[model samples]
Target: MFTRIASALLVAGLLATTAPAAHAQTTAAKKAAAAKKATAAKKAAAARTAATKAAAAKAVAARAVTPKAPVAAPAPLTEAQASAGVKEALNKGIIKAVQFASEPDGFNLNDDIHIPTPPDLEIVKSTVGRLPGMGLVFTQLETQLNRAAEAAAPKAKDIFLNALANISITDALTLVTSGSTDAATQFLRRSTQSQLISAFHPDIEAAIDQVGAGRAYATVTDKYNKIPLMTPVNLSLADYTTQKAVDGLFILLANEEAKIRKNPAARTSDILKTVFGR
Candidate 1:
């Protein structure tokens, strides 16, 4: 009976020890499983963070590479506005030209338009230049010729403006957009050259008489005739001075036209700004 009791006690002790070891092994296995699950959760969180950052970076790069909208172009110019603008420019040019030409010595001092000895009468001038005391007389005639031109210059403003008013610019936009500063001036020249020549002749003839060009011509011719064997010259001082005066006025007008057309400050009008401000 005692042996049986001893064996039963030993068995109870062994069961108690084995039960604690088994419980420890089960707890260790549960801790390992929890650590693996935490590691997986951490990896999943890092992947999501990396994916979110990459998407944000991609969006930023796309924004950086995006193109801007294009700018709108200006409205096209109308013919009416173009024509009026050219006319305005012409008017301004004409006024300035006339103002310049009407001033004292405007023709006399200006080498560009100062009347030259008639191209046909170079021999007459040469003969006169060689003759004694005729140099001074010829100088006087030259001065008087310029004075006649000056006298006729004031009449040009009215004539030019009248012609400009009557004439039409067939293609004002073509002229204005031609990018040539002298386009408007050329238009004025082509339209009014004939009328200007016609209108200037009578006034020029009168200016010649008024400025004593006849007396100067007589002095020159009389002195030339005295040179003997020189062909007797028959010339109209009125005709020469008139054509020259018209030509000079147009030259001045061209300068003024360029000023008004190309220089912004010379625009001096709202219409000009509207048309050329582009």
Candidate 2:
């Protein structure tokens, strides 16, 4: 019985040591499996990143090699076209200017072209204008002067058109290609100003008389002359009105020409667009 008990205790000690060794081996095997799975996942992620980079590079290369479509140049302008366009633009400007200047209160209300007291009458305005009731005479005269200008504005359209008709083809081409905004207007002014003054004087005189501007001027000047120690003021109302009226017309014409030259919307006709677009 004693020999059997000792053999049984030895068997229990062997089981305890062997059981711990078996547990350690199982834990080591599980750790090795987890490490291998982590390495496989890292390699898959690296491959996907590489594939995305390759796709972006390929797209950039494709775009770099592609050729874009070319743009077409504008058609060349002919001399005939330039001439016609210049005339058309001038005609449009002239018509609008005449219409604007001829309207009631056109010259009087427009600060840009409004005729003020004449330079010769400056002393009268400075001295006599300070007087009660005398100041109104100057104001009335100025209003009537502008009114006369408005009445005479329509007569200038036919004369302006006639002058435009005589512009040579070379001159028209020069005007079209001059690169100056008011080149056409300047040309008209230089060529037609003298003729306009001569043709417009009688009309302006009649208009001034009809509008009572002449009487207003006489009344103002008469009052100024009656003032003690004042020099007699003498100005030809007809001459002054004619010159100022022509100047006002040119001012309006230049503005219109500038619009046609610089603004695309002002190019109303095909001829204007074709010539001025360039």
Q: State, as a TM-score between 0 and 1, how close model 2 is to the true structure.
A: 0.78
lDDT of 2 by residue, 162-251 (tens): 999989998988899897899999999998999889988888899889988888888778888998887788899889988999999999
For candidate 1, the per-residue lDDT at 214 reads 82
**Where does candidate 1 stray beyond 4 Å?**
1-71
**Candidate achieving the largest TM-score:** 2
> For this target, which candidate reaches the highest lDDT against the unseen true structure?
2
Angstrom error of the Cα, residue 216, model 1: value is 1.3
Worst 10 residues of 2 by lDDT: 68-77
Reference-based lDDT, residue 261, model 2 = 92
Per-residue error at 62 for model 2, in Å? 7.7
How accurate locally is residue 183 in candidate 1, as Cα lDDT from 0 to 100? 79
